[model samples]
Target: MNVSQPGLSRSIALLEREVGAKVLERGRQGAQLNAMGTALIFHAEALEAILERAREDTLLRSLGLEGSVKLGVTPITAAGIVPRALEILVKAAPKIHVSVTEGLDSEIAEMLRRGHVDLVVSRIGGGSGYQELAEEELFRSDWGLITRPDHPIARRASVRLSDLRDVRWVLPAGGSAFRQQMERVFASSNLGWPTQSINTNSILAIKAIVMSTDCVSLMARELVGVEVAARRLCIIALKGVENQRPVGVMWRRNETLSPVAARVLEILRRISKDELAVRKRVELPKKGGRSVV
Candidate 1:
């Protein structure tokens, strides 16, 4: 990028010759990348990522470090699952350092494709580009109505999406894929969305508000394992509401993970089995029923 005019011209000439097309659309103002240029840059960035991982490995080896991982997660997983996994991961391989980043589906999915993050742990079916990545399903959790234990809906012996229609809602930030998915449940049932709602991306905020008020929200059950255990919140458990929104480990197809990332992936899978077992021990809510955390 810091090349002289002559050097830059030479590099562009070489690239155009190799690709058999002009990589740039030159104009009097300067130049802009063509389709070929954009595609080449994407692959070039991926190549840089592969080399960067190799470089990290080399440096770690010389310095006698166990290595580190950059792990991407969604908010739901960050709530309980990832922390639980890390508890085991740290004890299992204490030397391996894991740097965790929590983001919305749109953000993390792109990071996975660009190799900005070594691996992404999230629910399947984000949208168009998500299906291109390979998946290793870890665990499945249900989505449903969540409310405080003393709330009126919590007292109902039988409930439906109709019951949630008029209630105040604690919704995710507007326009997030997660928020869209939540809104779809109501739309699918002709219930429409709640006109009265609180929007936030924080799992803690959702839990706090749901536990103290009648504002119901939808989320994966696994996200609130702790509050469920302590009886701080309860599920409105819907029947036949379509579960599997299963969370799993995702990475670019045909990509090889670095030693550190691979180790973390192994621990995530190992811990997920215990998560799979929790489906049998809900104590609070029934499985085979719709749930939200």
Candidate 2:
């Protein structure tokens, strides 16, 4: 009558029929599942394990996280966050293997469109024809002016575009939103940003150049904070700039995610608070952003 007790009732029924003997002397003192009943229990235990494996395999394949997932990201990922996220995921699911690659935002986006990369982490621009790609805003950063400690303008707590009128600049490549923002700030001040520059996304390379020259670069405050604290570089707040730059997650809209990719995205959505705090100390927004995983 009680099918719920798999260990007792089921085993008793199974063993009694198999052995043609009263394996369990039920309704007696201390009577329990007998040797034959116990043997049946062990067999059922093994059978459960087999069924569980089948179920897990089916789920893993359906999610696309089992075999492999390829990702393309910008230089920042190579520096820390993505790699660290993968490290945590590997510890949790030892069998899942993930491959990560790095490239410029445009290049990564191309790879995703061509079915080359499963996911991409980069700046979203234009959004011209990415109907197949879905974007999820991950975090945002503020742009600040960075220069060597001894640079003439380094003494200022903050700087307006007018203050930087004659200062030489190192900027991102022509199409970057940051560069556009800088140009707009300069234009609003009735001045022009020096076009002679080193254009790069390599933070360390840019830092090295800034530390060695009188040139200034605009970047996330957290990116140069370490050098600032060490007096190798200094941060001058931008007085007339919009501080929000949204970083996002991108993946194919219609395609299914692999099991490993799904798990990686899970770890990535948690990336803002747990991962960013260690790398840049930036505040990750809660509540509004949608998570793919």
Candidate 3:
């Protein structure tokens, strides 16, 4: 990818010779993909996916184990459901390998479509227009107005959406679903946006800023689970069910999961159910592999 222009042109020329057709239409401007190139590229990507899957299976057969999975996740999912689910997976099936890619939903959608990832764990918000993909609900968590315990908003007996109009916020950047959720809350209540938006998508950064400063955040309750349980953060009990949504497993429709991936999926379902129960109750579950979240 970092090669010089002449070197790249030589490589493309070689490919064109092997294909017995001019894949690139070369001009003074630069080489551009021809119609033949465009068609070839689609099947090339599909072939790459098949090769990757075959390799994972071959490695599994050599090692006498289940296999590997390419797992895609949104940032929120990495912080929330993934950790607890993987913890159980490794203990239950230590021989299986997992590779995780963390990105925004849009980026992850493309990855899933191209077969760069075998499955996706993310929140479902209308979703990208990939009818080939299907989602299975794993857990549901509500969006909350969160702040430090001693913050002015937290001390209030009751809060309103208008109260947040003047509040400073540590929010995700405009493109994120989390940010859209926050905007929806304000718009539905006929309130203006926050006076100061301290933009970031990191749950860790949001929690750190909220605890050290007077800023508030609109976040999924499950994302701040450990901190909330430790009294380091608190939800204001606004928008109980209004913005609640399912966190699910998204994979290609009609494609059977690889053996190791199916095993990991089973563990994810088990851990997510337990994780949900804890958030709804005052205390956590006493069971092992189910209480980490």
Q: Give the alpha carbon lDDT tens digit for every residue of 101-136 in model 3.
A: 988777887788778888899887565778888888
lDDT of each: 0.76, 0.69, 0.77
Could you give me the TM-score of model 1 versus the true structure?
0.86
**Comparison by TM-score, 2 against 3, better one:** 3
TM per candidate: 0.86, 0.62, 0.78
Better of 1 and 2 by TM-score: 1
**lDDT tens digits, residue span 106-132, model 1:** 688788787778888888755445555
Give lDDT for model 1.
0.76
Off by over 4 Å in 3: 1-40, 60-65, 274-293
For residue 167, give model 3's deviation from the true position in Å. 2.1
lDDT of 2 at 278: 64
The lDDT ranking, best first, is 3, 1, 2
Which structure among the candidates has the greatest TM-score?
Answer: 1
